[model samples]
Target: MITLKNITLRRGAKVILDGASATINPGEKVGLVGRNGAGKSTLFALLNGSIHEDGGDFSIPAQWRMAQVAQDMPETDESATDFVLAGDTALAAVNAEVAAAEASEDGERMAHAYMALQDVGAHDAPARAQALILGLGFQNPELDRPVNSFSGGWRMRLQLARALMAPSDLLLLDEPTNHLDLDALVWLEAWLQRYAGTLLVISHDREFLDAITNVTLHIESAQLKRYGGNYSRFEDMRAEQLALQQASYSKQQDKIAHLQKFIARFKAQASKAKQAQSRVKALERMEKIGPVLAEADFTFEFKEPANLPNPMLTLQGVSCGYPSAEASAAPTTIVRNVGKSVLAGQRIGILGANGQGKSTLVKTIAGDLKPIAGEIVQGKGLAIGYFAQQELDVLRPQDTPLEHMIRLARDTTQAGRLSGQSTREQDLRSYLGSFNFTGDQVKQAVGSMSGGEKARLVLALLVWQRPNLLLLDEPTNHLDLATREALSVALNEFEGALMLVSHDRALLRAVCDEFWLVTRGGVLPFDGDLDDYQRYLLEEAKRQREAIKASATGQAAASVPAAAATAPVVNSPLNASSTAKPVPRENNRTRQMRKELEQCEARMAALSQEKQGIEARLNANPALDEIQRLSTRMAALQTELDGVEARWLELGNALEAAT
Candidate 1:
C-alpha cells in the first residue's frame, strides 16, 4: 500500500502540489490523470522517492519491488535478449552466485545457490525474456540483434519490454502505448489484464485508462482528488459534481446581487443608514463561492478540398519494397501484387503486425517509396499530404512555428500550387491560432515545445497543404485525448480519401469504414472487425508456439543419427535434393551460430555509423559537454566492437568445422 498526507511538492519556485493527500491500496490499478504539467509526473516522482515532500508524509512498503520504464535512451552493444534478461536483477545475482560456488568447489554453498536459482525460476528466464520480446512485436531474428541497431521508437519498445520482464510488486508506466501499433497494443492490454502487481499509470489515452485501471486519481487546483472507478466513470462523477457546483454558485450570486441593490438604495437615507451598514457588513462577512470553471476544449477541421476525383489513386499489381544498393540489382519486395483503387470518400485503415509491410504500403501510396514491380496512377491534379510516424523527423527543430509556416508558404508559392493560396505573416498567425498556438507561442522554437505541440504543428503544416488525399501513419502518437478527439472529428468530416495507420483503436473505429489487412507479403481486405482481428492474433500466436515446439522436437531427434557416418551432415539451402542425389541435413547448432554471427556483423555496422555521426558532430563544433559525452560513448562502443569481432571470428571457425 501507498499513502501520502498533506504532501507539498515544488519545482524551484513553483508549487505543483499543495496539501494534496491520497491513499492507494495494495493491488489497485490506478490511473493518474490531469492536464499537462498538473503535477501528475511530480506525484509519481514523489512516490518513487526521487523527490521528497516539502511537508507531510509519503510511505510505501519497503519489501515491495518496483519497476519502471526508463526515460533515457540506452546506448550499448548488448543484445536485446540480454538487455531484457538484465531486468531481473535478483535472478541474475542468484545465477552469478551459483557460477562462483561451482568454480570454488563449495558443496554446501553450491546447493544453496542452486536452490535460490530454482526459487526465482532462473532456469526459465531466457524463455520468459523471449516471450516478452515477441509479445512486444519483435521478430525472432531481432532478438539477437544489438539494442543500438534499432531506431529510437523500437528502442523505446525494448525499454518497455525490459520493464515488463522484471518481477515486481509495483509497476509504474507513463505513456506505455505511445510507441506501439494496434497489434502490440492489444497484446499489451491482455498482458496487463493478467498482471497481479499493483499498477499506477499516467497516460493521455482515455480508452487505455478505461480498459486497464480500476481507480482514477485526478490532480486539479493543487489538490489530489480520488475517484472510485475507471476514467469513464470518473468523468461521469466529475460532471455531476460540476453541475451541482454551478447551480449553487448561480443561487448565491442572485442573493448577493439583491443584497447589493438594497444597500445602494438605503445607504443614502439617514434613517436607513444604520440598517444599510449592517447589511453591508453581513455581505462582506459572508464566505464567497467562486463559479465553476469548465475544462478547455480544442476543435479544428481540415479545409474542404477544391477537387475530389472519383478515384484518387489506383495501384495495379503493385509490389512495394526498397531498392538494392547495386545498380542492376532487383528490388527487395515486401508487399507483392497489390491491386487497389482508393476512392475520394474512402476511409481505409491499414492493419497488420509490426514489420509486416503496413508502412511499406503507405509509403508506396504516398510516393515516398517507388513500387518495385507495378505502377501507381494518380488522378489529375491530385494533391497528397503525408504524415510520417516520426513527426519530429519531418520538422525543423530549431525553427519556430511562424518560420515553418513562412517557409511552407514560400515553397508553395514558388512551386505554383493551386489548392492553398499564399498567405502573409498575419494570416498564418490567425491560422495557427485555431490550432491553439496563439500570441507569443507562435514564436516559440519547435525544439523547446512539448510532444503535443510538435504534433499539432505537424498537423497545421499538413492542413495548409490542402491535399485531397491523406496518408497518416500514427498521427495521434504524441497527441492528448482532446486533440485526438478533435482530429477524429475533423477526419470524419473530411471529404477527401484517407489511409490511416494508427494504434488508437478509438480513432480507427471512429474514422475508418473499411479495413485492409497486410499479412504474409500480401494486401487483402479483412472481412471482420477489430474484435475478430484480435481473436486472429491470439490464434496466430498459439500457432507460432506450436510450430516452434515441433521444430525443436525434430531438431533434438535429428541430432542422433540412425548409424554413424564417415562425414558430418551439412545442410544448405543451395544443396537441393533431387531423385538422383540427396543433400545432408544442417545441424541446429551451426544455424544458431551463423545467425548470431550475422547479428554481430549488424551490430558492428551500426557502431561504425554511430562513429561517423560523432565525427560529423565534432566537425560541426558541438558544445563542450556534448562533445565529452559523445567522445566517451564512442570509446566504449569501439571497445565493445572489438569484442564482437573476436566472437564473430570464433563463430565463423566453429561453423566451418561443423560443415
Candidate 2:
C-alpha cells in the first residue's frame, strides 16, 4: 500500500501539492487526472521517489518492485527484442550466472544456476518479450531490427513494451496510449486488465481509463481527492457534489440577506436592539461555504467557409503512395485505384490498422504528396486546411503562438486575398485567445509548451484558414478530455467537409457520419460503423495468426520428400505437375515421432496450466511453507516443460524431413 499524509511538494517556486493526502491500496488501478500542468506528473514523480516531499510523510513499501516507461529516446543499435528482454533483470542475472558457471567448469554451480534460470522462466523470456512487442504493434520481421532504426513514435512503443516486460509490483504509466493506434490501444487495455499489480496511470483518454481503472484520483486546487470509480463515475459524482454545494450556498446567501435586512431595519429601535445585536453575532459566527467554481471550459468553432463548393475534391482512379528518389523508377503505390468524392459538410472517417496507408491517403488529398497515377480534380476555389499527426513537424519550435498565427495569416494572404483576414498582431492574439492561449502564454515559445498546448495551437491555425475541406490525422493524440470534447463540439458545428484519421473512438462516433476503410492496398467504403470495425480488427488479427501458422506448416511439409531414403520417391510438392499422384504414407519411425510430438505437447500444456495456477496462488501471499512447496514444484515443472518442448520440436523436424 502507498500512503501520503498532508504532503507538500514543490518544484522551484511553484507549489504543486499542498496539504494533499491520499491512500492508494495494493492492487488498485487508479487513474490520475487533472488539467494540463495541474501536477499529475509531479505527483507521479513523488511516488517514484525522483523527488522528495517538502512537508509531510509519503511512503510506499520499500520492497515493492516498480516499473515505468523510460522517457529518453534510446540511441542504441541493439536489437529491439534484446532491448525489451533487458527489462527482466532477474532473468538476465540468472542467465549471466549460468554462463559464468559454465566458463568456470563448476558442475555443482552450473546445476544451481540452471535451477535459478528455470525458476525465473528465463528460457521462455524471449517468447514473452516477443508477445509484448507484437501486442504493441511491432511486426514479426521488426523484432530483430535495431532499436535505433525506428522513428520517434515507434521508439516510444518500444519503451512501452519494455516497461510491460518488467516483472513489477507497482507500475506507473503516463500517457502510454499517446503513440498507439486503435489496435494497439485495445491490446494494451487487455494487457492492463490482466496486470496483477498496483497501477497508477495518467491519461487523457476517457475510454481507456474507464476500461482499466477502478479508482480515480483527481488533483484540484492543490488537494488530492479520491473517487470510488472510474473517470465517468468521477465526473458524475463531481457534478452531483457541485450541484448540492451550489444549492447550500444559495440557501446560506438567502439567510444572510434576511439577517442583514432585519438588522438594518431594527438596529436603532430600543425594543429590537438586542435582537439586532444577536442577528449580527450570528451572521459573524456562521461558517461560510464558498461558491463552487466551474471548471474552465474551452469552446471554438471553425469559421464558415467563403464558398461551400459541391464536390470540393474528386479523386479519379487515384493511386496514393510515395514517389521514388530516382526519376526513372515507378512510384510505390499503397492504396490503388481509389475513386472518391468529397462534398461540403460531409464527415468521413478513414479507418484502418497502422501502416495501412491512412496517412498516405490523407497526404495525397492534402496535396503534400502527389497521387502516383490519377487526377485530383479540385472544384472552383477549393481550399483545404490540413492537420498532420505530428504536431511538432508543422509547428516552429522557436516561434510563439502569436508568431505562428501571424506567419500563417501572411502566407495565406499572399497565396490568395481572402476578405476579413488580418495579419495584425493584436488580431492574432485575439485569435489565439479563443484557443486558450492568453496573456504571456501568447509570447512563450512553442517548444517549451506542453503537447496539449501545441495541439491546440495547431487546431487554432487550421481553424483560421477557413478552408472548405479539413483533413485531420490523429488531431486528438495529445489533447486532454476537455480539449477533445471541445474539438468534437467544434467539428460538429463545422460547416466544411472533413476527412479525419483518428484512433479515438468517441471522436469518430461523434463527428463522422461515414467510414472509409484502407486495407490490403485498396480503399473502399466500409459497410459498418466503429463497433463493427472493432470486431473486424479482432477477426483479422486471429486470421493473420492462423495464416502464419498454416504457412509454416506448409513450408515444413514441402521439405519432407527430400529426406526419404530406401522408399518409393514422391514428387516434391513445390515441383509437382498438375497430374502428380498422392504421396505415400510416412515410414514407422516418422509416425512414431509424430505421436511422441503430440504426447509431448499435451504434457507441456498441462504443466503450463499447473504452473500458472501456482503463480496465481503465490500472488495471494500464501504461507511460507506453501510458497516454498509451490516454488519447488514450479521449478520442476519448468524443467520438464522445457525438455518436453525441445523434444516436440525435434520430433516435428524429423517428421517433416522423413516424409
Instruction: In model 1, state the lDDT of residue 360.
Output: 77
Tens digits of per-residue lDDT for model 2, 286-369: 999889988889999988899988999899999976554445544445578999899888999998776667887898899977
TM-score for each predicted model, relative to the true structure: 0.82, 0.81
> Cα lDDT of all candidates, in order?
0.84, 0.85
Q: Model 2: C-alpha RMSD to truth?
A: 13.4
Candidate 1 lDDT at 122 equals 74
Query: Which of the numbered candidates is closest to the native, going by highest TM-score?
Result: 1
Q: Give the per-residue lDDT of model 1 (tens digit) for 1-659.
A: 89989989998888988988999998999999888888888888987889899988889999999999999898889999899999988898898999999999999999999999999987567767777777777766667878886667778988999999889999999899998877778778888888899999988777788889999999998899999999999999999999999998999999999999989999999999999999899899988887998767999998889899878999999998655444444444557999999998999999997767788788889887789888999999789999987656668889999999999998888899943575879999999999999999999999999999999999999998888999999899899888999999999999899999988888989999999999877999998998898888766666655554565557656776667534556795444455446457777887799899999999988876555444333322245565466556655666787898899899999888888
What is the alpha-carbon lDDT for the whole of candidate 1?
A: 0.84
Model 1: per-residue Cα lDDT at residue 9? 91
